[model samples]
Target: MAGKEGKGAVKDSRINPFEDTVQRLRETFRTGRTRPAEFRAAQLRALGRFLQDNKQLLQEALAQDLKKSAFESDLSEIILCQNEVDLALRSLHSWMKDEPVARNLLTQLDSAFIRKEPFGLVLIIAPWNYPLNLTLVPLVGALAAGNCVMLKPSEISQGTEKVLTEVLPQYLDQSCFAVVQGGPKEAQQLLQHKFDYIFFTGSPRVGKIVMTAAAKHLTPVTLELGGKNPCYVDDNCDPQTVANRVAWFRYFNTGQTCVAPDYILCSPMMQEKLVPALQSTITRFYGEDPRSSPDLGRIISEKHFQRLRGLLSSGRVAIGGQSDESDRYIAPTVLVDVAETEPVMQEEIFGPILPIMNVRSLDEAVDFINRREKPLALYAFSRSQQVVNQVLDRTSSGSFGGNEGFMYMTLSSMPFGGVGLSGMGRYHGKFSFDTFSNHRGCLLSCSGLEKLNDIRYPPYSDWNKQLIRWVLGPKSCTLL
Candidate 1:
């Protein structure tokens, strides 16, 4: 009875948690306490401890939201968040170091350096796919960059949201980091307010909305959106190795991963070999009936269950098409003979369903992928360097991987994000810290050079003009 009343009250009030977050952050920034590097380090360590102590809670939250197994949750979400914390903790001093730049010909008389300064406040809207890591990791970056952050965890994953709200405050300074929980309406309300930077990871449709909303404030945004991530099965790759990797990705969190291989693009002969291997691999991993298998995960909710059900109406099912509502499980489904017009082909199928499409040549697959929206990730499985280069040269995606699936996300050195339609900006490790910071270029000029600067004064002369040309123009080859 109270739940119904609470729903009505929420609808009537339409109160936005972000408003509170921004208000608190503004007050915190005014204190000038966060300017110290020591403060940032302390907070980061606290965050690290929080993740370590509450590993089980995090795991259970993911299970409640996505039916993710303990092992998969650790690999994909919890451990990654912890890794980001460790990375920031270890390298923060280097990131904050004042980087000097060698002066160009014109600026030789001046000293120039890039100072990485924190943006005052940042907002991160995380997706449900990897809810724990996506939200926490961005907040980690914001903290390391010495910016106040307001994290809006996806409400769809209520279990994760609950843990975050309960646990984050204990470890983090409430003013510097605020974890807000709500649905799309709450996110929409939050987007209305301006922030120095906004990091979002979700669907493309919502990415556009986030962009459009950010436009009102002229805020810079980092959008990490999904695409029809392609996984090419070339003949050269070790069939067993490729199959094992592919199967692992396809079934990880029941294929509810942003970087999960959405479609497999391969030759007819390769498909014949790949299909059987994939089938055997799936069986080996999850056993004969995924519906009853403890290793397999269930759909996040009824809405998604319906979405997957609709895709079946249009596409021809090749393997494993089973569902049990009581268990909230969908078997590892593989579809062949799927038309480009089908719904599965149209959108990012964020489920355990995998689609295999036969192509006449590599060029055909590349053209087909290019014709659609750019993906957040495109994976090409090939042993041949030439085939890898062909995929890289012909297609456009947010990020690419060779002979692997979803591994690009693991690299802290490399930036993680998407391109057009897939996403706008990049984040991860140092890249993320920089994303939350603004590199302010500072130039120092010598007072002794004031006489030399006077040569370009308002009193014009032929000699002055020639000197100006020589100074302003591109340098010549001869040494003085």
Candidate 2:
């Protein structure tokens, strides 16, 4: 009996490590050491150094995990994170300032403002695809907003995860930040703890679980989830250009990106032109054999590789449908005559596969998109601006890109997020800072203004009532 009790005690200790880390971070937050703007700036600078010093290490890890090229790693992960860090460092002061608001006659003499205060402790659960960018971008905002954070990076990306766990802590202040590593079990345990703010980036199925856990504590959440993003290419556009843009985004990161074009909707005539154009673009970009090209990335894991290999049978392969199991490589593939009811069409094809389905006209394409769950992004390629505007006016998505792909993500000024089933809440630049903060509505009145505030006191008369109404009424300038 004593032996069994001792074994149970040892088991409990193993599970308590994450709980202990969260408690420690909460204690650090109570100390108010992370609240100062200077401390936040120093942390941001350290993060920048972490990126700069370990650039090669990150590149190699990314390559090992996803076969990502040096250029792709820099552009998609390291550079994007570095840009976020730079933007936060430059704008931290302005973002941290209390915003002054207008007052009515009742409080014209008082100071009215919205104070952005940190939410104490924050939890960020990032996905495997674009792991560093997705994780660090939110981390920059949480830290800049002066919140102690706990980051849960995806365990699937083992190589990148190792670098983050092993090296990232050496750069930042350990007391105010921590990295907890594990699979779903660790995530489930972490969610049981109370965090002031929770930010998650993953699939909607897992997103629901995160929200359910957060609801237990009434914790605010920013869910950056994914969906089947649709791309509509009008017949009026140049087929080659449309194909280039679509192919680039669809196959970027081996199509593991949340915002990548999941499928294509176009007319029968346009589909014919697009197939050849896409074939040309794929060959041009990846050479005659994509598997031999050093630029193209391989699938992240054997499980995903097998899943993609199974999807090849869904439709008639028009461009590329080759796979190598040993290397976990799926050639840049495109399919036509794909039925809407097929498995490839029903789910997000997060692989190097693009399925083009025929739509009679723009109205049909719009109807098809509207009938499904709102996506993280919607794309339309057309030479006519009116056609683009028509699609934009008729649909709702987290973001709309006409004659482009996911290039809008490069601009930090725009808020990046999803709607409805895709996800909730916005982030990037100032949006991220705001998302991690509590906008406390505050007003300060003079201590000696009691006499002025007596208009509606116990001795309220008709004249005093009229005066109060007049003071509270809307201003003529406001009406104008």
Candidate 3:
């Protein structure tokens, strides 16, 4: 259950089947028919209709597997999908426009520009957590950039994957926008086939495998992986606001989110005050018996259920460690007296459980984080400008939120990704569009300028060198 079982004897499935699909899509890109605005618009419209028509099915499927509420599903999955389509609809014409740039020094006689071109066929391997949103978001980018996509949804979330496979092909073209359904075997097949680009979202362990596969073809990749996202609390911050923000974030998707606050590093003095506030805030959010609360969601599966349950046994539970397997519920739990070397502290908790580690001073807390791997997101609660600045300068995370939590990841305009072990690239809104598109440098020269080549035909002369320097040197004076 921890690692891939079959290594030597069994053929690696993550490479070969994924490759076959890409081979088919590559043929479509080779046809030269993908360059038209009409073709791009048609695909976007088809995708939009596909998502809208099957919105209810997707919402229900997510709820069945992950207990994701309808509002959460629609807001995170459907609205974002519609928004991407809207952006693509309004901007595809302009995004496809040829941009001209200023010519410099030696190239003054030539016109220079950059053309944003498609990366031919692309393969997007999405994660099970936030299955619909992760899958569709990348698909939007691929279509917006005018590239064919072969989407492979995680089999762990089988219900949602079945829904996507059943519904997506009804509206979109298989050759341009196809969904392949399978487990590790199918993913391996797809990765083996040469693709211009590969976008993968999952854990760092699997991300390494994807990167290794991509390296075989020298295909560029954008990996969105997880890290131990941390939270810091300064003494000056409002206890109520801090508690409310942390509770809401910890409960989101039962804390299965990649950007959720995994643990907190706070002052020893603020620990007692912060704990009560968080307990109160959690009660207010879900009331008593959070298992029965519709607003409060359940853990995604039994495996995750046992994993979080084991964390409770590792340390003293400070607040809320209730669980019911039949309900698939684990109350939002917080741990105190947690050792720095504890198993939960060593890796991303990725559950409703949160660990609070206390230090003597703010500097100590910052140093503790600095010593660990960089996280995907960092949150610090403080009203003091100096405290905020110090934390921001001291540690590195993919994104930052001060006195807030998890909201930054939702901002479509902001780029979302990790650094070091967290992730390799960012993709959202225009960033997403750029991730799937290749910007090519272009230069143009008039036929009449052919005589200018004489200056470079025999460039060994001192006179020519001086003449070239005169024309290419930086200007320091204003012309009359």
Candidate 4:
């Protein structure tokens, strides 16, 4: 019995690969190595170098995992990370500065400001669909905020995972950052341990699990979950223009994006027009044979391929439906005349499948969209501004695109995130830094103000009470 107990203890000690790693990172963070703006900028610069020096390797890994092209890799993943790093480096000084606040009558002479402090240790869990962008983008923010970050790259994308594990850590400070090396089991084990903050980008179902675990330790979490985003088309719009924009964004990244329009809401007549227009756009975007197109990427895994294949049977295949399981290649597809009760409409279709449903009128389209959870992104197409405004005013989403797609992500000034089930917090530029940092309210009062502090202490008469109330006016702060 003693030998058996000893053997069990040995296995349990080695169960979580991150136990030692997290401990070491926590120790390093306590040393104040990551607190200064200079050190933070240095790490951000090193991260930028990591992206530049290993651009080819990253592209190759992405190709191996998702069959992504060099152009797509550069445009979507590498460039985005680089831009984030550059922005962080340039803005680190100002971001680190203490922000002053308006003072009240009592504290007029005292210094008051909000200081942004690091949360110590952070955990970032990335999704497989965008292995690089999703992982590094959050890391950029965490590091800029002077937090020791542990990056958990998606295990499903093994090629990219290998690079992130073996290559990424070499570029940044080893003491402040780590790349977790394991699968789902290891991830679950790591979650058992507490973290200061957790930033997760994946499906909503998994997001709940992360939040539940974080709840035990009272750790704050940012869940970047995916949802069924809707794109509405009005009768007064150009079919070809809308089709081109929607098709490009939908099919971008093989339709694996979280913000991609999952389905279309339009009238029967508009659906009829969009069907042919979308067909032409798909053919033009990816030659006659999409399977042969280099711009097109394969599904990240066989499990995802099978799941997407199952959704293909939901509605009538209006445009492209051909798929090859052998290569994990799913052709850009369009489903028409889909019912709201269908499986495609029920969940986030994170594949190259776009389903179009018929609505009788604009009010009916709005009603259909409002029936489900709010989407991460909502798009409406119309030549008239009033028609677009109506949809915008009625619906609430994390973000909106008027006759466009997720192009808003390219700008560093614009913050990105979801609402409700789609996601919880915003991150992209300054928002990312703020998400990881704790804004500490601070006030450094004058050291010689002892006499003023004693306002009728232990002898609070009616006159003193009235004076206190009068001093704290409507516009003044109640903090006094």
User: Worst ten-residue run, lDDT, model 2?
Assistant: 1-10
Error of 4 at 130 (Å): 1.1
* Candidate lDDT values, in order: 0.81, 0.89, 0.82, 0.88
In angstroms, the error of model 1 at 331 is 0.6
Error of 2 at 236 (Å): 0.6
Compared with the true structure, what per-residue lDDT tens digits does model 3 show for residues 300-374? 778888888888775689889988888778999999999988988987787899999988878898988889898
| Regions more than 4 Å wrong, model 1 | 1-20, 447-449, 476-480
Alpha-carbon RMSD, each predicted model: 3.8, 4.1, 4.9, 4.2
Q: Report the number of the highest-lDDT candidate.
A: 2
- Per-prediction TM-score to the true structure, in the order listed: 0.93, 0.96, 0.93, 0.96
Model 2, range 1-480, lDDT digits (tens) per residue?
A: 001221211123454646666777899999999999999999999999999999999999999888899999999999989999999999999999999987777787888899999999999999888878998999999999999988888899988888887778778887888877788987898899999999999999999999999999999999999899999999999999998899999989988999999999999999989999999999999899889988888888888889989999998998889999999989999998999999899888889999999999999999999999999999999999999999999999999899999999998899999999999999999999999999999999889968888885878899999887777778611210
Lowest lDDT sum, 10 consecutive residues, model 1, at: 1-10
Q: Global CA lDDT of candidate 3, please?
A: 0.82
lDDT of residue 287 for candidate 3 = 83
What is residue 243's positional error in candidate 2, in angstroms? Answer: 0.9
* CA lDDT, candidate 3, residue 276: 95
Superposed by TM-score, candidate 3 places the C-alpha of residue 465 at a distance from the truth, in angstroms, of 0.7
**Per-residue lDDT of 48 in model 1:** 91
